[model samples]
Every structure is written in structure tokens, then in C-alpha cells.
Target chain A: MFVIYCPYCEEHREEEEFHASGQAHLARPLDPDNCTDKEWGDFLYFRKNPRGLHQELWQHTAGCRKFFNITRDTVSYKILETYKVGESPKVNLEDASHG
Target chain B: MDTVNVSNQYATNSVTERAEFGDSNTPVIASALEHANMKSLAVKTATGLGVTLVELPVTGMLVLRARDDKPALAAALKSSLQLDLPNVLASNVVVDNGKSYCARWIAPDEWLLSCPLQDAFEIEQNIRTAAGASSIAIVNVSGGFTTIMLSGNNANDVLKKSVTYDVHPSHFTVGKVVNTVFSKAQVTMRCLDTNHYEFIVRRSFADYVWLWLQVASAEYGISIEIE
Candidate 1:
């Protein structure tokens, strides 16, 4: 089985140790009180479920009780990296294309 | 080496006196960070009572603390422990070398590195240099704690006595590690395999925990391993 790194416990555990939280890097609006209904709706519900190399958030509910990110290929189920919640992951398509 | 034998007569007492190590006046032997018999600390259980229990001896454990500012220290940890330090929660990294394994990044500023009891100091030294100039802390806690590998039939029943977390297989399967309060003590619990788990607790609390475990497993019978 694949191992995902937990930002809270700070270790890479088996995938079984984690629960997938759809979509990573989702942010709240700067001013929720001023935002439109559509902005709030998009912020709350929209996500990218691409065929390859998708980034998502996950939780280790049983282990350290923290959240982190996982970059995986949905089609192949191959995970590229698991990083901390606040930090950005290393796998960017833009960077990969340049290299 | 001294085991306080609780007669069947005193089994009714909630707080029974266990044959103690260290000072006699102390309520319980705080094996927390103390070496018990050169092997890890453990509690022995009587058989034929349907009591299910497991004991782990001086398994080595280390605690590493660092911050995001300490890039060098983090790198050193990566090279030394060979596991990535996730800045978030519920994750762990494992690297093995024959007899021992190192599990790193169990917390934001802390990491737990476990090995054979004797290798504790050496492992500490290797990581110490990597932590220079960083506001980091690495403490040798092998003395304060010992481990119990609990699994097999009725393992969950034993855990239920101490932990408030849900240990149901559907929630806590293999490879998950949790730090939770166990009765009056706090422990770092890791699910090893489907039927096995590893509980690391302070040594001073071993006797108390051991006693509580007996009460918890009054039905399944316990097996003791004396090395």
C-alpha cells in the first residue's frame, strides 16, 4: 500500500491511516460579508477533479488529528507527494513543463 | 525484578499495592523514562482468567522537536531519520534497517524515533549535530517510557479501558498512530497490523496502567512474555 505523509504527526504513514478530503488549497473569501451569492457558492462547492495529477486535502483522524495535502493521479492512484496544510506542494504543472 | 503479587483476595481493591521499584513511598513506580530490567518495562498478567493482554519491553523511542525556520535541522532529520517531516497532521514516515524502524514527524515540532534500547544514545548523537543552531529539542525518553504490543483477539476490549478514541477497525485500522489519554495517563498508540498494536506510555505509570489493563481484560485471558 502507498504511504502518505501527515503534516500533523509529521510522518509518512500507510494510506489506510488517512481519510481523503477532496481538493486542497481551497481558500475562504477575503470578505465573506461583502461577497456575492455566486462567489460564496463557488468557494464552498467548486473543485477540480482532473483525470491526472489532482491535488486534494486529507486528514489523519486516527493518528495525529491533522490535515495535509496529497497530489495523486486519479486514474492510476499513484501519489506524487504529501505536504503540510499551509505549505504549497512541489508538483506544479507549470514548473514541470518548464523543466 | 520485584513483582508485587496481588493475591486473589486483594483483587477486589481498586487501588492495590504492587511490588514497587524505586522508592516504596511512591504510589506507583514511574517507569516513565526509567529502564526496567535492561529490557523495556512491562506488566505481567495472570492466566486462565480470560484476560487478554500484551506487553512490550525496552523498545527504543526518541522525541525530536524543530520548527519551520530550521531548514538545516529539518534536512539533518531527513538524512538521519530518512523520513519526511509533514508540517500537518495524521501522517508518519517509516524507514527500516534490519532489526529496527524509525517513525518520524509525529508532531509539528516533535518526531518519534524508535529503535533497539541500546541504540538510543547513538541515534540521539547522530541527530543532535543536525540540530545545531536551531531552536530544537531532542530528548532521550527511552527511560521514561516502555511499549506494549497489543493485538490478537480482544485487543480492542483492552484498549477500551484506557482510551476514549474509537478503536473500531473501521475507524482505526493498521498503521494509524494516535496520542490520546488512557485512563489517568496519556499514551502514543500505533496500530501495527490488523490484529496488532503498539502502545507507548510513561514508565512511572506502567504499574497503574498494568493494573487498569487487568480490570479491562478480565474476560479474555492474558499471555506474558518474559525475556
Candidate 2:
């Protein structure tokens, strides 16, 4: 079982306590009323299923009940880091391939 | 013969007639384990029991939520409850005027405060008045949850088998609390002392947890304590 670390709780908890929400850092259109249908549809329905390093939003459902971002390697299923919302991830796709 | 008479009396009262709509002055209150038959289960074991489980009497509980202005919130709590907001994953307990008050950090912006049941309403009003104009939420959740004390020689073993979270003394020291799953049920677990733990569980799940505890502590002899 994966022991995921919750940034808010500042401790590693069992994976059963967490739930993956989706891809993180999705920006809503500034002017939704004037935005094209494609933009709105993309924001609502689309999600990236990246193979390598990916950034995803996760909620510590059983712990603090707070949502945070997790940078993980999808292929290796290894969590690189976990950070709170509105914070930038330290590990990028390029950084994963080299190290 | 006594059981038959009791069943007959219960059958005589229709479902609607059995309901008591008491006035505010004499409002009736019942604990979540009212029907658990805990009193009958309070056993006096001959051998040393490994786990002792007790359902603490109903107490007042409040959920305080504030996104920002923590200092203002802390000040209000201090003024009203004579308690301090605990740090993350920590809990603080204090006794004021013979009434014990506890504040447990539930999240970054949420904390659970509990006190004597009789003083809940007054405490809520005091905190609200103290936090006038501040963006904070104080909800009276006393009836929504219940506290269970699990302690004994093998309490840690029972916890380790029930929850996925680490319950080792080194990792879960005294005063530390965590919201985690216990046998598919959600519970807020707090370490009171060595091999002593408290669980704040939802009222609806009280029966489930009570039964689960019995089964989990079966191998290690379980005893019930009535409050």
C-alpha cells in the first residue's frame, strides 16, 4: 500500500486515506461568458493521463480533508513530493527523466 | 418472565405514540449507544483483560472553522473557553472551574472543541460573542458524534490491527490526534497516554464501531466499561 504524505497534516498516511482528484493547476477562463465552448468543455471534461512525471490534485479525505498537489512518476508509481494548493511543484518532467 | 413482560409493554406502544415531543424545558436526550446494552456487557473478567473499552457519556462538541484571522479566533477561544488552539495534529486539554475543555486540531482551519455537555450552549454563545464580526464558524456538533475510550495492556495491539495508520508509541505520542479510518469507519483518534487512546466517531457509526471493537479485541480479551 502506498504511504502518501499529506502536506497539510505533515505526515505520511496510508493510501486508503487519500483520493486522487485529477490533474492539478487547471486555470479557469478569466471571462467565462465570452470564452469559446472548447475552452469551457476542456476545463470541465478533459484531463491528461501522462505517462512520466505528472502533477495531480489529491484530497486527504480521512485526515485534514484538505486538497493538495502531488508530483508523482506515473510509470514508477513513486510520489516525488506533495505541496499545498496554490504552491508550485519542485519536480518537473525534465527533472524526473534525468534523476 | 421479565423479558416477556418488557417485550409486551414495548409492543403496546405504537410507533407514533412512543415518540415523546418534549418541550424545550424538559428536552429528552439519549446517547448514541442508548440501545447497545453496554451495561449488560460490562463484564468482570477473571483474568487480566487485554483491552478495556468504554463509551464516555455524551459531551458537548463544537466545530470551529476559520480560514484566516487565526489570531482573532485564538483570542476569542482563549477568552471564552480558557483554552488555546492546538498546533497541527495536536490537542490541548485544560480544566477550568472543574469543567474539562479540550481542543483538537482537525485541519489547517478547523478545530474540534469539547466540554461538559451542560455548558455547550453557553460556551457557544460566549465564543460567538467574543468573535463578533470575525469570519469564523462555530457549529454545535455534540449530538453528531460520540467519544470512546480504548485502553488496557493490549490497546495498542488492537489499534494496530484495526487502523492502517501507525499507532506505535514512538509515532503517536500523547496529545497527538489524527483523523483516519478504523475498519472502514472514519474516526478521529487521539493518544491520551501509553496504550490509552480516544476515538471520536460519528453517532451513526457508534454501533458499528462498538461491534467492530469487540471482534477486533476478541483474541485479546475485551471488557466493557459503562460510564
Candidate 3:
């Protein structure tokens, strides 16, 4: 199991303390009431299943109980970085794809 | 006091009389392990005792939380408990004589303060008063948790088998506290000395944690002491 750093707790804790909540940085439509059913469904259900670097939303369930984003390599299972909610990941898929 | 009803109940039941009136009527205080009755089990299994386990008496615990750091709040806590809020996770403290509190860091904006059970209510009241108009929350959670101290030469060995965190002195030094997984439950643990560590386990899971400890310490030998 991967040990994830909790941005709030400032400690690297075991994966049991965390729950991966899927893709991160998916902003909702400005006016959801005006969106078509298909648009809403796409926003609600679709997620990126990247092979390399992936941005994920995770909650430190057993520790701080704070939600944060992590840039992890799905293949290697290496966590490049973890940032708090409302913060952006410094490591991106584009950089991993190119560099 | 429900003056009329209380008096009526007092007269009707001797149990109620003992519970309600007179200083001679001392209340029976039950520890988290009241049901387990660990003393009998420990007496049966007493051995060389490489790991020492002690369940501290019911302690007063308070959880303090605030989104933002405020100087006024810090000063207020200092004035009330003579404890400096451990802003850093590595600096949590356990003071008995001079300060009478063990301030543990729970999260970025949260802290757990432990004192004598009798002092919990007063400390909670003091923290609320100190917080004033600030957006802060202080809660009395004494009844919800209990403390267990793990010490002796093989204490670290037993901890390694039980937890994922690196308990090596090089990594987790004295005064550091962390909320992490312990067996199947989460415990707020702090290192008092190299071989000594304290765990704050929730009441419901106290028995489970103790059971885990007993099994883990089997190879190292173990002993139990009640407070």
C-alpha cells in the first residue's frame, strides 16, 4: 500500500488512513440548471483513467479527515505531490508525458 | 436540579439517595476496561514482562479547534492552562506537575488537551471563555477516550508490529504526536521517551486495542499495571 502525505497533518501516513475519491480539478458547470442532461451526466460520471500521472482527490479519513489532491503515477504508484483542497498540483500529467 | 422530582425520587430509592445526596456517598467510577476486568487476565499471564502496559485513570480530555491562528487565543490558553499550543506536530507535550496538561496536536487547526478528569470541565469552560468572539470550538470529550502507556525495552518492537508509522527514535522523536492507524482503529500516539509511548484510544475500541497489544507483545513478554 502507498503511504500518502496528508497536507494538513504534515505527516506521511499509511494508505488505510486515506480513501481515493477519484479524479481531481473537475469544476462543475457555472449554471447547472441550464445544462443539458448529457452535459450533467458527463460531469457527474466521467473520470480520467490515465496510465501515467493522474490527479486524484483523496480524503485522510482516519487522520485529519481533510480532502486533498495528489499527483500520482498510476503505473508506478508513486505519489509525486499532495496539496490541500482549493490548491493546484505542481506536478501535472503534461509534464510527466513530456519530461 | 429538578427540585421536586429529585426529592421525590430520593425518598423512594436508596440508590437515588446515594447518587444524589451526601458527601459520604462516593460515586462508582468505571474505567473503559471495567467490563474486561484485565486484572484477572494479567495475573494469570504475568511473565518476564518485556513490555509494560498501564491504563491511566479516567482523564479529562478537551478538543480545541480554530480555522485560523489567533494570538489572543494562544495567550488565553497559556493563561488558563500554562500550556503553549503545539503549532508544530513534533512539539506536543505531556506536563504533569508544573503545567498539569498534555497538549497534543490533532490536525493543522485542532489540538487535544488532557488534564485531571476533574479539571476537564473547568478547562473547557476556560477555553470557551478565552476564545471570546473568535471562531473557535472547544469540546469536552473525556468520557469518549482513555489512555494507554506502552514502555519497556521491547515496547518499540511491539509498536513496529502494530503500526505503520516509523517509531524509531531517529524518525519519531520525543514529544511528537501523530494520529495514525493502530491495529484496526485510529489512535493519537505520542512518544514520551525512547521506549515509552502513550496512546489515546477511543472508549469503544479500548478493549480491541488492548487485545492487539497483548498479542503483539507475546514474543517480548508482557505485564499489565492498572492506575
lDDT of 2 at B125: 73
Kindly report the docking quality category of candidate 2: high
Docking class of 1: incorrect
Better of 1 and 2 by lDDT: 2
Off by more than 4 A, model 3:
B1-29, B45-48, B94-99
* Residue B208 local lDDT, model 1: 73
DockQ of each: 0.18, 0.88, 0.67
Local accuracy by lDDT, each model = 0.64, 0.86, 0.80
* TM-score to true structure, per model: 0.53, 0.90, 0.87
Among these predicted structures, which one has the highest TM-score?
2
Q: Ten residues in a row with the worst lDDT in model 2 chain B? A: B1-10
Which is better, 1 or 3, measured by TM-score? 3
State the local distance difference test value for candidate 3.
0.80
Q: Sort every candidate by DockQ, greatest first.
A: 2, 3, 1
Worst 10 residues of 3 chain A by lDDT: A88-97
What does the lDDT read for residue B201 in candidate 1?
A: 77
Writing each residue's lDDT as its tens digit, candidate 2 over A1-99 gives 779989999999999999999899999999999999999999999988988888999999988999999998889999999999988888877866777
Local error of candidate 3 at A1, Å? 2.2
